[model samples]
Target: MTGKSRAPNLMVFGVLLCLGLLFLVLPAYHAGNLARIMVLAVYAMGYNLLFGYTGLLSLGHAMFFAAGMYGLGLSMTGWGLSPVPAFAVGVGAATLASAIIGFLALRTRGVAFMIVTLMFAQAGYLVILYFGAYTRGDEGFVIQQADRMIAGIDLSGDAARYFTAFILFAVCFLGLAWLVRAPFGRTLIAIRENEERAQMLGYDTTMYKLRAMIVSGAISGAAGAGYALLFGYVGATFATVQYSIFPLLWVLLGGAGTLIGPLVGVFFMFYLIDISSAVTSAYMLIAGLALVLLTLFAPQGFAGELRKRVFAWLP
Candidate 1:
């Protein structure tokens, strides 16, 4: 095709994508599903920042996620704070908590680091589970005011919440994209490629790792806040091993190193689960099999494979 023809095609594609997004955000689409997908995408993106960009694998991301949820839950219920400020407080709390955890975990490498993080997350989960009074144990906290107005906008309406989430997702993704292109991001890549060499070159690998963890945690926390608002509840289930593993699956299945890959993976996995749940009582089994097949057959993920095909077609 001529360059002129290609330009129009590209414009049409962009317009279609925007329209599709608008359709997804429509109130008739069901707020629960949209919010679930958006929050999960945000969570997956946070995990991708560390695993994809920094080459650090974490198996305890649920800890940060839970931290955010509980932070928002407690603030709103306990202190009667508004949702927006509560979310901000939750993000700060989660970031600080992750920073401390990352500080200790960064001292180790490889599987040890993964284990330490997992253990920490599990410990957190157990604490919430056992503390029935504070966390309401397994009963969970019902968000009675999830529909409350913030900045003169009611969150109870599906359209409003969907747009709010979409805006937040776009902002976070753009900020992350900018961050990965900055000098600090380059340093992170350097550390990921060769920590020892980076250290020898006078780079502070620990600080870099901690900073990455903080950013990842903060973003994940915000996602958690969104999750709570959408679901109108917070439960111990949010802090499960499954939650942590899901993000890893998203990163791996979407093409870990690419920004769009995780988002693509989120859509694929969520839809897969949605379909599987409709077909069988054992949704986990179906989802697990799908993940295994994707990992084995498409190691570079859907986005990576698509990129290869596109390049081949171009040539």
Candidate 2:
């Protein structure tokens, strides 16, 4: 609608073009790394919809992500479903899980709400881990060899798998870009700014929040499915609290609420980890130190601070 609002979309196009070119020029091994970065970006954007727009800070996003990953894996390995159907099964399970959690947690507010979500997510995580027969516990389960292919496309190939991730990321980027410009997205922002005021104005704040949670969960779930499909592995790590912090780190580093923030955040951290891993096994220590410095200096996040100082004139 305005120059300020359109800036993010323009940035998205530029970034995606750069990513495409990077994949084209880089070796397949490196390109696959970029593809994982794309999936992580999708995860961060989904979380941003709730944290950046609706002002909901959830620490249990791993529950939703794990739902999708395990859902797809189990569907294919145990239920004998094809790749596409298994993906849908994973997404649906995540959406439903998020809805249930949102419905129950919305009863509280602020700190209480955050704790409620964390508890629920933790309990679910434990259940998934203990039920080794279904999820194979920490070892995880892989998709059946027969169910790995979709129609004529051989997803076993790294190139095809990376392309699949690219397409999913591109479609999601476009969809989320359009969403933030729509009326529904605007309402989430309004709720975020002042929930009580929105309620006074006759908007159902709870319903809007629930919808945002479901949407966020579904998107994160889809990313999880893509991840399992790409790597052919679904493990307990994806469901842990440690993993949930990753998207938060990405969003804060790149700037929450900005459409391109997740992309920048993912690229920076992904490369940071990738490069650091070659030299030392303690790469996470390096990552943690960087995050600490970012917290001290750029607390508003890279994208948020950029807009405040440089792009203040933009929408």
- Leading candidate by TM-score: 2
RMSD of each: 3.9, 1.8
In terms of lDDT, model 2 sits at 0.87
lDDT of each: 0.81, 0.87
The worst-scoring run of ten residues by lDDT in candidate 1 lies at 7-16
Model 1 Cα lDDT, one tens digit per residue, 1-315: 577546534543453366347646556654556556767888898998899889999999998998999999889988989888999888988898899999999999999999999999999999998887888977898888543568877776777767777766777776776687689888888988999999999998888899999999999988888788766789999898988998999988987866667777887888888888899988889778877898789887876787676532210
- How many clashing pairs does model 2 include? 2
TM-score of 1: 0.89
Work out the TM-score per prediction. Answer: 0.89, 0.95
Itemize residue pairs with steric clashes in candidate 2: 4-314, 4-315
Assess candidate 1 and give its lDDT.
Answer: 0.81
Error of 2 at 85 (Å): 1.0
Residue runs of model 1 more than 4 Å from their true location after superposition: 1-20, 24-27, 30-32, 308-315
